[model samples]
Target: MLEVLNNDWKRLLEEKMYLCVSIALTICSIVAAIVLTNTMQTKGNIAMVVTDQSANTSLSKKFSSSPYFHVSKMKKAPLESDMVQNRYDAIVTMKEDGSYNIKTIKSDDMKKMIVGALNNPDSYVPSNDKDREIGTNIMGYMMMFVLIQGLFYARFFAKDKEEHIIKRVVTSPIAFRKYLFGHATFILGMIFAPTFAVILIAKILGVAIGFSLLTYALLIAVLSILATAFALFLNSFFCVADTANMIGTATITLTTILAGSFYSFTKKESVLDKLVHLLPQKDFINYVNALEKGHLSRNIELQFIYVLVISAIFFLIAVMKTKRDYVYR
Candidate 1:
């Protein structure tokens, strides 16, 4: 496996274009995610229509001064459409007693911050993740790029089959399983380095790239492993790189979109929703969103487990198919 790994690295010298483009696209997408997120006004935009005029002026003047929130007094309750458009993050309505009612398109998590802000003028720290998830958007854009990069890297495995390189390994001291494992390791390592680099650079730049560096690495590593497994599975079924790639691109684009990689995925009582749930990307993205709100139990790690199981399933199918086709035959 080590020799196989080394040999593949040397082969990559002749295939640098794919590798370089993968890195370039990954970086470009990260930048785009950041730009799009920042361009949208978010987080601090609040419309306060307190029923008590005295409390209204006082609280608005108070919390608005805090950096974490901006309080704009409204003549009436702000429209839900304004909230949908992100013009207002939330609407605060205070009673004569000074107690308040809050409404927003976002979750209750932001409400806690609002209440705390009203209670203490000095309370402005981010209670959890920032209202806009810079990190989530970056990873969201990344899903499509990394998945395709996996198919490109796995082309090496298909190249071996087409060139009869595996026949030599079959009769050599190396078992077929090791050869397959070697290919997977090489693909995983190659994909991880560039992906991890994006997170490292973001952290260094002090960008709100969402999660901690360790967390990003864990997520990327798991995603990379899944990509490698998917690539291997596709290549096993179709040894010709072109054929595998054509099928992979179409399949990945459609599924990733359906998984709602870019936008929100709506669920309904239909077979389509069930199909979307079966997609690993859907669960992966949902888990990320869940983590941001602190509703996620870190101990459970159920979503990660599900993704890993899918990866294993892909790898097993690839191994079983190849063993039957090339080794047993």
Candidate 2:
């Protein structure tokens, strides 16, 4: 097993395709981080018009003092169209009766920050928790990428058969199980080593590396293993690599989207949220968020464990299905 794993690693390192893909993924992740940070920073700066004389005085002082808030005071009441046209974050109108009306001109970060500040903090929560939970979510998304790549790798199995490499390996001392495991080992190394390097860079740069590194490591490992099992299962079932790739890509993409990798489905009380709960990504994000808030829910743990169990089941199915054929072809 060790020999097989080492050989697989060596093969992957020699492959230019692996290196190129890793570099591309790293660039994309960095770009995403930059965009998210800038968006958050821009949102923190908001322009507001004070309506109530007393509230205006209090708010002006508060916004001026807080680093998160950028306040602009306007003397006259601006029309809604004017506020929108002028690109003001929000407009505050002070009524003669001492009441106040706050209107958001846009839905940018500035508007969100202003709303958060004006509304009760307890009543209005920002998706900034999603920001904190991003590290975990990124890890999960990467695992999905790994799984997709693993499925792509399954195509190589058929190629090897076409080239008679499977027969040559079968005739050698390499056991069928060892050969499959060797391939899986290689795939895992390809998926994880550079990913961990990225995580290390993120930590050095002062990103809040989550509370339990071990838990995260475990989660990623489990997901990767599941991906490997899925690859093996596809290889066992399909004669053509294209079929496996198409099916794998579609399935993984759908699951990740449903899991809320792009936009969170949890905020919506629609059918999507209920459907997404069955997937691991949403539950994993929820778990990470709970951990960030210093609260861990049993349900979250159960959901994670459920995903692990499903992974195990997939692995078992793959092993059973593939055990009959020692030859890769």
Among the numbered candidates, top TM-score falls to 1
- Report how far residue 198 has shifted in candidate 2, in Å: 1.6
lDDT of 2 by residue, 206-256 (tens): 766554556656655766666676777766676666777788789888887
After superposition on all C-alphas, the RMSD of every candidate to the true structure, in Å, is 7.1, 7.3
* Tens-digit lDDT string for candidate 1 (1-329): 99889988988988899889999989998998898887754346888885546455565667767676667866688788998776887888766666678887554567777888888866556654434377778888898899888988888899998888877889999988788999999999989999899779888998778888888888898889989999999999986889999999899999998887886424355567777888898878767766655667763368658888999999999999999888898
In model 2, what are the clashing residue pairs, if there are any?
43-109, 43-110, 51-94
TM-score of each: 0.72, 0.65
Task: Give the local distance difference test score of model 1.
Answer: 0.81
Runs of candidate 2 exceeding 4 Å displacement: 10-14, 34-38, 41-134, 140-143, 152-158, 161-164, 167-172, 205-216, 266-269, 325-329
Report RMSD for candidate 1.
Answer: 7.1
Report the number of clashing residue pairs per model.
Answer: 0, 3
